[model samples]
Target: MIAGEFYKWTDKKGTVHFTDNYLSIPHEYRHQIKIQKMEETSEKKMEGIAAELLIKKSVNEERKAISDGEKAFNEKCTKCHSLSGKNQDDSATQLVGLLYSDKFKESTLPVSEDSVKRIIKEGGGEDMPSFPEMTDKELNELMRYLIPYLKKK
Candidate 1:
């Protein structure tokens, strides 16, 4: 049957009937009938649902990445670099200023992201311990978490 067209008529008992065929509807009521369009195709509806699902999945993945990055940073870096600057010792530098320091901003010496990653992986001289066991995915997430603070504008 064709979509979007409707026929309306009153039966002999004066009850109203609605059908899709205009020819089956009594001749007198055809002039007063109005066409009603279908809302959307099943494919279009499914596409909309798919789009919503993709958006939800993307958001969930982003949240998971942020959470994992935070956890990795807390576990791996907090011992040497204090977030609040209250518990930092002389053996390790406070991280709050490391990103904005002249060395980091200029990407000089041991201050760039590549340098930081290498330090995280290989240990920074005698004071820092190596985290060679960290997976590539974990490192990427950790870097993403640090990028906003560490990257020069």
Candidate 2:
């Protein structure tokens, strides 16, 4: 129709009813029903839809980042590093309890995001080679994946 409208009414039991069709109102309450413009309702609906879409987008992006981070770790660091404290090689370092490790706890440097990022980008002695080629996005995603496993301070 040219203009949209809303019909609202309250029943004898104080239950409120709302509808867009005028004919849906009961015969007895038809004359007492209040008429409202659809503009406010449409705006509210649009806002709700927008918020829901935004939340879904954020969740999808987070899942993708986690997946990418796991892939990156498998490709780049899994050879010499072990997650879940299961070392394939005795020489490899266990990365599961990074903050809780004797090396990190004993060292003057705290186990922090900056320190971890630096170690990944730079080298942690001859055993660990620097990955200067790793992009910032890949590093960030990898860090996110590792954050949960890292022992909190």
Candidate 3:
């Protein structure tokens, strides 16, 4: 049936009643009857619910991307780079701090998303090797994981 306005009230017997006619309600129940505009309330509630679900879905997707990124890092980058600065050594670079390190800051490349992605895709000089085989989606997931560790100037 098409949505329309209606009145609802609870009677003395505690039975809830609904009717489209306002005057049909008993005079005593009239004081407590609520006028509900079905179309407006339903549409608004649905919109609110849809927005909430979209936000939740986006959060979940980002979380999954971050998790995937961490996995990729462990599989491909842990040998030469460390996320916790505990693996600082002759061969390993502890990438635990901001991207503003002397190495990155001094380079010709700017500290932006595109630059960072390019650096990752095409090696960062003698020490860093290029990930020529890594897919763009994988690279994006890896970036999501590394974002928390990098602070921009």
Against the unseen true structure, what C-alpha lDDT does each candidate score? 0.66, 0.75, 0.75
Where model 1 places Cα greater than 4 Å from the true spot, the runs are 1-41, 85-92, 97-100, 105-112, 151-153
Model 1 scores a C-alpha lDDT of: 0.66
lDDT of 3 by residue, 90-140 (tens): 433666554766666777778777787887899886888999898999999
Question: Cα lDDT of model 3 overall?
Answer: 0.75
**Whole-model lDDT, model 2:** 0.75
lDDT by residue (tens digit), candidate 1, 31-148 = 7675544444365754554565477568878778878988999887876675564433342465555656654556645666777778778887588888899877888788877766
For model 2 the TM-score comes to: 0.65
lDDT of candidate 2 over 30-68, digit per residue (tens):
988777666756787646545654775688789899889
Model 1 per-residue lDDT at 102: 58
What TM-score should be assigned to candidate 3? 0.66
Clashing residue pairs, backbone N/CA/C < 3 A, model 3: none
Backbone clash pairs for candidate 2 read none
After best superposition, candidate 1 residue 46: deviation in angstroms? 2.9
Clash-forming residue pairs, model 1: none
